[model samples]
Target: MKKILVITLAALLSVFFIDRSYSKHNQAVIQKTLINEIKEHRQEPIVTIDFRKLYDFKWDEVYVFTPGTSLKNIEQTLGFTWLDAKSTGIKNRDDMDLIVFVENNQVAQYIMLPRKYGTLQPMAQKGNFMVKTS
Candidate 1:
């Protein structure tokens, strides 16, 4: 009986880990696709964002990157390079607005942009827009 119970528990644990891994793999695929799309659309015009709703967050620093800014530079600008290189999707120059959220002096979810910015739809809506001038 004890042998059977141990086998059952091990099987359940393995299944749980497998499911978690698969879920994470699925998310990475989605993010990779999105990053590729951003790269493909590099020539596209900059997207606008309304800052009214954005001010709600207690961001330690907010930066507006214009055309021709590299992703690594952004990491440097934020004064931290601990996040994944792919976190920002693609290089800036798409008029990327980075809103940083800090907790206990540590960055919280540097991956927020890639996950929240699908089609950049949540932004580019009605409100005061910052026009980028070359």
Candidate 2:
């Protein structure tokens, strides 16, 4: 009976690990596909943000923002809501707005632009912010 129980437990553990790995793999594939699509067709030019200057955000290296990052995370990181970020003004430019793309209730991508001029800037600039999350 003990041998049978041990064998059953081992089988269950193996199945669980396999399922978890597969799920992670699928998520990664989905993220990669989405990023590739965005890179190929994004309207605004691509610019790499120096995340280090911003608050310390702990996430996977491959993804710009971790999968499942919520509004709470945004508030914590930026000390403001998405709308607030968008409505914020820029020097010598009209109002700025953030174009947020959400997927499954999480932020998938965001792009910032001047209200009148559609130009891309460094992430540190007032009217520039772009990111992709899983």
Top-TM-score candidate index: 1
Q: Per-candidate TM vs. native?
A: 0.39, 0.36
Q: Would you give me the overall lDDT of model 1?
A: 0.48
Candidate 2 lDDT (Cα, 0 to 1): 0.43
Q: lDDT tens string, model 2, 1-134?
A: 99999999999999999976775575455435434544554554543434334323232211222323444555555433555332322222334433334444444444343333323333544423453321
Off by over 4 Å in 2: 43-134
Query: For residues 24-128, what per-residue lDDT tens digits would candidate 1 score against the true structure?
Result: 575455445445545554555543444445334343433444335576776676676635434544453353433333444455322223322333433344433
Backbone clash pairs for candidate 1 read none
lDDT of 2 at 62: 14
lDDT of each prediction vs. the true structure? 0.48, 0.43
Instruction: Kindly report which residue stretches of model 1 are placed more than 4 angstroms away from their true locations once superposed.
Output: 46-112, 115-119, 123-134
Q: Residue-pair clashes per candidate, as listed?
A: 0, 0
